[model samples]
Target: MSIQLIHAMNDLTATHKDLLELSKRKTEALTNNKLDEFQALLLEEQKLIRQLEKQEQKRQEAAEAWKDEQHHPAETLTITEILGRLDVEEQKMAEDAAVALTDTIRELKRQEHLNKALLEESMKFVQLSMELVNPSIQSMNYGTASSDKMSGRSLFDSKA
Candidate 1:
């Protein structure tokens, strides 16, 4: 294998480590309600994943060429032939990564939808309770505004 191939593999390994670390940090940010930080970390992780994929492609191509030469000892493969194999491997990796990323992003979106619905439902329950105890809130104008405001009507209303 060429020195370049070794370098590519090493680069991919480093990128993978960075991605894993970023993933952990993102999870921590999520737990701490640091959504902005979590999103930033996610973007950085994705970029690193792409870099890793690119390097892996180069390594795989070089390895395949080395294998082909070993398999056909009577003939030497042209540089172009080796590069062709590498290109094919790189393209395949790109497609696979795209599909994986798409699926993951879709799942995250679905989970976000569910979470939003749950939050809305919880707010509804709280609003219902306030209305039950203070029947005056059911009417727009019954008790003093401050009384309804303090009782949590304004709280849920502001949310809406």
Candidate 2:
């Protein structure tokens, strides 16, 4: 059971590393404004995320099974708690797997944050471009109070 738990943790770590790589590529795609590449990365990311979720579920189940076998009284058990019941060799493996997974997930979060900021900036740029291309007449008006009263009139009077 401990072995199963360790295996699940290792699998999760591997998947997380792959996701981190994808995140790096996505950041590059966003930076370069490669819409097609970005879209492809998004699809790949989704697939990985689904796989990660399944791995997480399996890890949880393994942990639960270990807890049951060990006769742990707690309704829920953490990896650290489970580690206490493991032998020295298994403890080391689980610890290493957990640490690696944690580090990779942290890095992935940082990369995702950067990507989000880039996307927001891109959206702002597109909005600015659209406004420039089709600015409202009200926005074009920069007149004093008296001129403001002639709101509906054309800027240039043909009869003048």
Candidate 3:
């Protein structure tokens, strides 16, 4: 049982490593503003995310089975908690998996933060371009102006 749990953790560790690599690629794509490449990478990321969800389900099942056999409750348990109940060798394997998973998650988060900043910067640049192109339009207001003299024409009209 402990061996099975160890195997599951090792599988999770590998998949998380792959996810970290994918996140790095996503950050690169976003920073470069490669829309085609970014879309392809997003699809790939979604697929891997589904795989990770399945692996999580498997890990949960294994954890529950181990808990039941040991007369432990069915409550949610972290990998470290489960490792505490295992033998010496299995505990070592689980510990290694935990460490690898933690490192991969940390790196992934860093990449995601960078990507978010890049995306926000791009959006701000686009908004600035829009403002420059249409200086008359305060914004895309859809009516409800404070005056009755103001025209009801669309705010996006370039000729107005």
Candidate 4:
């Protein structure tokens, strides 16, 4: 059971590493403004996320099984707790896997934030360009009260 748990953890770590790589690629796509590539990456990311979810479920089941084997009374078991019951070599393996997974997850989050900022900046640029091309009407209010009626009118007539 401990072996199964360890295997599950390693599998999860591998999947996370894959996801981290994808995130880096996504960042590149966003920076380069490659909409098609970004869309493809998003689809790939969704598939990876689904695989990760399944691996996570398997890990949970393994942990529960290990806990049952150990006769642990708690409703939940932590990796540390599982480590305590493992042999030295197994403990080392689990600890290394956990650390690798944690680091990958942290890096992925940072990359995601960076991508979000880049996307937002891109959107702002597009919006500014659109406004420049077709600006909305605003009140000039430089004339008499009668000019107030023209507040909502466009400066240039499109039908002209």
Give Cα distance to truth, residue 25, candidate 1, Å.
0.9
The model with the greatest TM-score is 2
Clashing pairs in 3: none
lDDT of 2 by residue, 90-148 (tens): 99998998899899889989989999999999999999999999997667766575686
Q: Is candidate 1 or candidate 4 better by TM-score?
A: 4
- Model 4 misplacement above 4 A: 139-160
lDDT (Cα, tens digit) per residue for candidate 4, span 47-104: 9999999999999999888888899998878888878878999999889888888888
The TM-scores, one per candidate, come to: 0.43, 0.88, 0.79, 0.85
RMSD of each: 14.0, 4.2, 8.2, 6.8
Error of 2 at 6 (Å): 0.9
Q: What global local distance difference test value does model 4 have? A: 0.88
Off by over 4 Å in 3: 138-160
Q: How many residue-pair clashes does candidate 2 contain?
A: 0
Q: In candidate 1, which residue pairs clash? A: none
Residue 134 displacement (Å), model 3: 2.2
Cα lDDT listed for each candidate: 0.59, 0.91, 0.80, 0.88
Tell me the tens digit of each residue's lDDT in model 1 across 54-146.
877897786666766547453544433444445566545544543454455465555556545654665687799988878665476666764
lDDT of 3 by residue, 94-131 (tens): 88877877788888788788878888998999989988
Q: Best-fitting candidate, measured by lDDT?
A: 2
Write down the TM-score for model 2.
0.88
